[model samples]
Target: MAIKVLVVDDSALIRNLLGEIINSEADLQLVGAAPDAFVAKQMVKQFQPDVITLDIEMPKVDGLRFLEVLMSARPTPVLMISTLTEAGADATIRSLELGAIDFIPKPKLGVAQGIEEYRSVILEKIRTAARSRVKTQRTKVKATSHLSYSSTEKIIAIGASTGGTEAIKSVMEAMPPNAPATVITQHMPPGYTSTFAKRLNNCSKMKVVEARGGERLLPGNAYLAPGDRHMRIVRSGADYRLELHDSERVSGHRPSVDFMFQSLVKSAGSNVVAALLTGMGKDGAQGLLALKQSGAFTLCQNEESCVVYGMPRAAVQLGAADKVLPLEAIPEAMIQQLEKVKAGSRL
Candidate 1:
């Protein structure tokens, strides 16, 4: 059976164009098209599409708000379509937090020209999203216990991409407010990291913010890699600090997870707990292996809970992860392990 797709956009032209593309592929079938969220909601029930292509801005209700409602009612994989401008990037990031599976930037030219330019990308995103399992957790749950850190210096380092927005949120929400300091690298565009940070802060127990140069890696705080720059761990006296650099993109991502993890291995060494989460690529796997070799406790999100099972799968296959966990269990497990190390230090 062909993968069913629903195209939702405010523009009639875009709705039709996307439908055409989806219907063209033998593997994908265009189940329906809607001009707005109101219509889209009804179509979802009627079409029962395997995937949805959603626009950010629309009449009556915006894409993000509609997505929230849609996921709550009936969880389905969604692929966001946004303009490539700075504003569009910002909205796209917000949509991710709201549960979009992935996104494709619309072109800057005329409607037809724009669609033509991004045709392949849009199709590719839809194809990838269709294969992913849509997981919408209805309840918040934590692991059996929290880790007790005897030393105040323990830190958590994490990396993710693709379906990471929701995945990261799942892990962070399950953690204690007083958990160890955390450093995260999630692939994102410039001007979007702040919004992502804010969203995470709103939903999580710990203080979450984008990393600023020279900021102290404080206990119970989480710092995200700033977009457009590489973030690395640096030691200052007895404390660990974040060093932001305008370096070349590694693995096609600025704020590369591999670069950050490799640096953490050098700066924090065995004192760090490294985690490789769900993503579409192998960027973090090699770095995670190095972290394991350097004596850092490493964990990878298991395939069952992962959006793509790419990065974490690579890490596990490379013998990097000391433990492989479900998405919802990662935070509590990390906290517990950190506490274990801390308790040992005090002994």
Candidate 2:
């Protein structure tokens, strides 16, 4: 069966255009259209849509408020339709925090096929969204054993995939504004990661930004690995820096979590916090183990709060995770671990 989609926008022109794009794809079907969030809520039950395309601006409640309520109540996958302007970017990022799966910039109705640029991405997002299964409230369970750590500027490396959109969000949201300079690898397409980084920057207190070559890893700044390249941390005497490499895809992933974690072990030795989040594969398992062998603080997401427990499960099986906690506690645990390092305590 085709993936059922509902397009919600105040403008009838935008609704019709989106309907056209979705209907053109054989795998996607436009089940319904709504002029605002209120109408969209009713249509959701009426149409039983697998995915919803939501506009951020509307007459009544607006998109962000609606998205929050929807995720808290119905928990359906939603794709944001936003303007390309600065305001749109801000709102788009906010929507993602509220559990929106992905987004497309607003189209210019004047130009021919202006809306078509988003057709491919929209369909792709819908397909991916339909497959996702993020829950309303994240769970955070404590680990059975205590993981050792100390107060030093250890290099932290993380990785995620599949339901990582919300998985990463929970982790970052729980972190302090002045957290460690962290690096992350998430499986996402080009242009998307940039937007994802921007979204994270807005929602999280930490400085979350897209990775660039040779940028210094500063305190409290979290760099996201670019889509096409692998991000590795290079030690420069006392300070740390980022290296964007086009190395062979490890475990079929360019920004492979294992690749970054393993490289950190070789460069920073045991001075690292290696984490594996919710994903569909075992990409980070072996690398996290490497970090553990080298004495790095290792963590993984437990099944309760994960959208899919595959990646973290693999890491646990490999004995990579020193502690496996629920989603809400990971950030707090990270902060504690980093404080231990800063205090110069023994691991």
Candidate 3:
């Protein structure tokens, strides 16, 4: 049987294009295409699609509002169609928080040209969404008491894709004010990381900011690798600073988890705590294994808590993760590992 897909976009061109692309795939079947949320609501009830391709900008009922309703009533897997603008990026991030599996940016040129260019990406995202786990209930994170560890000279490296924004927020919010200097690489496009960092900063006790190269790492602060760049950890004397550079895509992503993890292995070595979270591919598996081999305590989110379980599963299979934890348990696990390292038992 083919995977059922519904395309919801205000633009007839986009809807038709998506419909064609989806139907072109041997494993996919286009169930319906809606011009607005009103039509989409009816189509959703009638077609009961396995996956939905939603446009963020819709006429009457916006995509975000429609998504909230859909997740509440139906809870189907959704992939957002977004423009490559700042406002579009912000809204797209919000959609992810509301349970969208992923997003594809619209081209700056003509719709037909863009659709043709993104043919493979659109098809792949649909397939990925079909297999993804949709979270209907949001996890509420409570503030925690601060840990008293000396965060100086200790570093934490994290990497994720797909469901990473929410996963990163959960872990960051659970961290106390005295947490170690942390660096993160989440697979996102260029215009979105700043917005994502701001969102994380609002929820987290740590000051979360998009990394600017050459800034020294400080405790109680988190540096997010800016999108479209590879962020590396470099040491100068006793201080570790961020180094951001434009690079060819590695493992299909710039600002890749593999790049950051490999950098930590070279610079921070055993003084690091690294976690490879929920993502759709094996981007960070080998790098996490290298960190583990260098004596760093590594963790991967277990299948029960993951949205896709691809990256973490890969890391676990490669003998990289010292602990395979749930999303709610990972922050505490990191703190425990930090305590062990501080106690001179490891690192």
Candidate 4:
């Protein structure tokens, strides 16, 4: 049986283009293409698509409003087709919070030409979305950060891909104001990571900013890797400062989780605590293993809590994670490890 897909966009060009791509894949079937949310709602009820690709800026009923309703009522996997602008990025983040599995960044230029360059990427995201877990988000009372450890020397490194924005928010919001300096790398494009950082900052007690090379890592703050740059933790005398690299892609991502974790292996391995969260590929596996080998306390989100278990599964297969935990359990677990490491250092 082929995976059923529904394309919902106000533009006929996008709908037709996506239809063509879905039809090209033998394992994928295009169930319907709707020009607006009303038509999309009808198609969704009529075809019962396994996956939906929604344009964020749709006419009449917008994608976010429709997504909220669908999640409350139908709860199907959704992937937003978003413009790569700053505004688009902000809306995309909001969509993720509302239960979207992932997003497809629309080409800023010629539709056919720009999309042609990302043909493989577009298809892969669709397939990934099809397999993702879809559930309406539960309202959890925010956990106050109880991180009591005050060592600025300890570094927390986190990486995720698909379903990451929400996961990252979940972890960050629970962190206490006094938590150790943290670095996060979520596989995102350029304009989006900045928006993501801003969003996190609004909810998190710790100050969160996009990493821009040479900034010293400090306790009570978090740094997000720039979307286009590979962020590395480097020893600057006695301190750890962020370094951004415009190097070639590693493990198929520019600001790859693998590169970030592997970089820490040489710089602060023994003092680092890392977590590999829900993602669609094995990008963070080898690097997490390397960090574990270098004496870091490493964690991977358990399959039960993951939207896509590919990345964490790889780490588990490699014997990388010290603890395979649920999303709600990871933040406190990370802080506890920090406390343990701190106590051991004192001894």
- Candidate 4, position 259, lDDT: 96
TM-score of each: 0.83, 0.70, 0.96, 0.97
lDDT of each residue in 108-127, candidate 2, tens digit only: 46632777776766676678
lDDT of 3: 0.89
Deviation from native of the Cα of residue 93 in model 3, angstroms: 1.3
Ranking by lDDT, best first? 4, 3, 1, 2
| Count: clashes, candidate 4 | 1
| Count of backbone collisions in candidate 3 | 0
Please list the Cα RMSD from the true structure of every candidate, rounded to 1 decimal place. 3.6, 5.3, 2.1, 1.9
Q: Cα lDDT for residue 226, model 3?
A: 94
Model 4 clashing residue pairs (backbone): 145-176
Off by over 4 Å in 3: 141-144, 343-347
Q: After superposition, how far is residue 231 of candidate 3 from its true place, in Å?
A: 0.6
The 0-to-1 C-alpha lDDT of every candidate, in the order given, reads 0.82, 0.78, 0.89, 0.90
